[model samples]
Target: MGTKFRSSCPISSALDILGDKWTLLIIRDIMFGKKSTFKDFSSSGEKIASGILANRLAKLETLGILHKGKLPDNRKTVIYSLTQKGIELLPIIVDMILWSDNNLGDHVDEKMRELAKKIRLDKEAFVNNYTGHLKSLMAAL
Candidate 1:
């Protein structure tokens, strides 16, 4: 998985992998929405196209941010879970949620707005608790 970097800048380099519109959304779905299978993601409210979802899932796996697996009893079912590196993105995602809740106003969903309030109450605790939950989820996978 050789990715071409646009520049040596850290933000630019990170964007090379995550700057796309759909990549982080897919990550967001896996992290927050608890979406794992292709069908679950395809049925998301954003309605991402199948080709783009497949491409982004592959890219995330290549970048070491996601781990793809199969169900124990159902060989045909594909599942995706976040790696430790991907789990580290929780802070960034939480910050984005808070930022959107503050700036996006009504555009943000009610559930996210509620989450923003919880995040604001104690950001560190929220992140820590959620990170633990995600780690446990990964362990169960």
Candidate 2:
């Protein structure tokens, strides 16, 4: 995690926080995707290394992007949830997913393509629905 931006430019400053490969993936997992716990995250198909995962998690927390909490069912279990700042990344993720699905076509997963098709067919509805769902989930937390 960078302590300072390369320049005062908006893009430069934003990238200073999010430019690393692992950061966005961790954000995506915590904010909208499934994986939450250290174990769950390590188990993802992407297989992010333990050291890298730990570092990224701490960085995100330090940035106030997410917070760690005990699982409701088991106080012993640690889980992570996105702060409002982390949830704000959802639209960016949606855009990236749609772009890759369209531009890369067959290289993308069939299920993801189907999802992308649905999103493209009704982007506003999808965004609105997904955004609402995320907000509700955050509220429930």
lDDT of each: 0.93, 0.82
Error of 2 at 48 (Å): 0.5
* Whole-structure CA lDDT of model 1: 0.93
Error of 1 at 21 (Å): 0.4
Candidate 1 lDDT, tens digit per residue, 1-141? 699999999999989998998988888998889899999999999999999999999989998999999988898999999999999999999999999998999999998999899999999999999999999999998
> Which candidate tops TM-score?
1
Worst-scoring 10-residue span by lDDT in model 1: 23-32
For model 2, residues 1-141, the per-residue Cα lDDT tens digits are: 447778989988889888988888887776545777999889876889999999989888888888888888899998888877887787888888899996997898786788788889888888888877777776776
Shift in Å, residue 87, candidate 1: 0.6
The model with the greatest lDDT is 1
Which portions of model 1 show Cα errors greater than 4 Å? none
What TM-score against the true fold does each predicted structure earn? 0.97, 0.90
Cα RMSD (angstroms) for every candidate in the order listed: 0.9, 1.9
